[model samples]
Target: MASSSSNNTHGKNLRNAVVALLAPLPSIFFYLSFLRHYSAAAEAGSLSPLWTWCYHHPLLLANTLFFLNVNVLFWLIGVLQSSHWMIDLYWTMIPLLLIHYFSTHPLAQCNSWRSRLVILLTWVWSIRLTHSYFRREKWQWGAREDWRFSDMHQQYGQKWWWISFFAVYLAQQVFLMGICLPLYVVHSKDKQLNIWDLLASLVCLTGVTIAYFADTQLHNFVTRNERLKKLGQDLVPNLDEGLWQYSRHPNYFGEQLWWWGLVIFAWNLGCGWCFVGALVNSLCLAYVTILVEERMLKQQYRAEAYKNYRKRTSVWIPWFKTSLTGKEKET
Candidate 1:
């Protein structure tokens, strides 16, 4: 019976793997069709109405099409596999793709030092975050979905099929676009690199490094704990060393800092409105994501170790100590 169950699991994974490989073809074909139509219109003096509309509102059209493609992909994959975590793979990737698209546009003046700097920093940050997700989530062609999404599957039952489309995929699409507004602002202007750009770069680099270390430490700890569990030994509920000791969510803090650094870059270029994206992103991280994650950890562990860590460590800021009463105290 165990062997039969293992074979069934392997068959399901193989099917998912095949679906994942083929799913992106439609999106790619749509993009290519657009490019072909646009090129033909450029050669001729007249364009089809659809192409004309796309040309007039390139960014809006492109982003909308991308979002549609993502939603379709996720919906189909989710329905087939009864899982929504496939969308998580693209969460960090879409921003980088958008920035690359804008930065490489003819009107973007990609040659400017400022544009190059933003592109470079964004690429570094995106690649690091994506790699971290790949490692931590084991997000290969056919991997287990995240536990959170699995729980949602159980909670929502049949309704989760459609709900995942909006709640999981579309919601993330909106957040991704909003958080990446600074990339648009940076690419829109042909500004020279300034002192503020240097400072922003430093801040972004520091945040990326901090996030990298935090994830590394956490991953190592989890690996060790799993090994100990296999040996029937007790496992640690939470990590309290290195950056984890300073902040309950150091990786999250680093992520916010990185986005804020991008905001600083745009603000220095006089794009005050772009700050809205950064502000909203930070608020969501603080009030929504961190809160949900911590609540889950608290429930799952229900141990004094995690509770004490929560009491002493700042939730979203590193080195800002918290009192037992849950009030912030300057360290």
Candidate 2:
């Protein structure tokens, strides 16, 4: 029994390591657009057509990389992390990956510099987020379900587990593919850089900064609030004490900005499908983030004080001059 458990754990560790190692490979191919007008320089006498095709069609490597780096690798994240919620993380990535494949032809888009830059930035973000999330969580694998999900399961009852699992899993897979459409298309196109790409990269950076700050602030708030609550004081404000003053979800705002920035980048590259596809992705993320995160915050607070904040704060869009839509002040 001991030997079997040890072997399992060792195998899991190997899998997670492999996943991490392969993390950045697929996006590389997706952004570079290696296949448009590809030709075999060598004479037919020297090399077979099949060999030449594979030689020039480097994106096939990316296709292989996807299965190795993403799809199959995520299973390892689940197995090694000991929490099925790791699977949730994996599910989240599916939408991003699929979005890339669907919105843009990986080999085609990478030809364009603007589109390629978008892919680079997107890949960087993914790698950073995935690594951070994996590292932060306890890796005991199956030891504990995420508390929020656990609570949800209890509320829903056992019958909902399978349904919930697949629902979220499938949704995330679809989402992953949808949002990443820009990079794939642009990279495959072999387009050039333009004004829009510059503007979009800035937008992406701004969104990332805002989202990072909001997330950090919220995490700190939760930690401090828990400590304060133990001593029995009125609940510490978790909402908009800082950037939250203007927007209910600073993080969501940033998140939306990032995707739109990608869209704009794709637009500069002259790819219609990628640009429009990224637009759809931006809309969905905004909707889901607001629904899931905003609702959770409101439910948790549920107070007259919170009502005041809600009334004053914009759900997402920042009010440039003032808060509360310039409506009457509430105490």
TM-score top scorer: 1
- Candidate 2 residue-wise lDDT, 254-321, digit = tens: 87788777777666666656556556666776666555655555565555556666666677876532
Superposed on all Cα atoms, the candidates' RMSDs to the truth, in angstroms, are 3.6, 6.8
Q: After superposition, how far is residue 103 of candidate 2 from its true place, in Å?
A: 15
Residue 241, model 1: lDDT of 91
Worst 10 residues of 1 by lDDT: 322-331
Model 1 has an lDDT value of 0.76
Candidate 1 lDDT, 198-286, residue by residue in tens: 89999999899999999989899988988988999877777889998898788888888898898888888788787787788787777
The C-alpha TM-scores of every prediction are 0.86, 0.64
User: What local distance difference test score does each model get?
Assistant: 0.76, 0.58
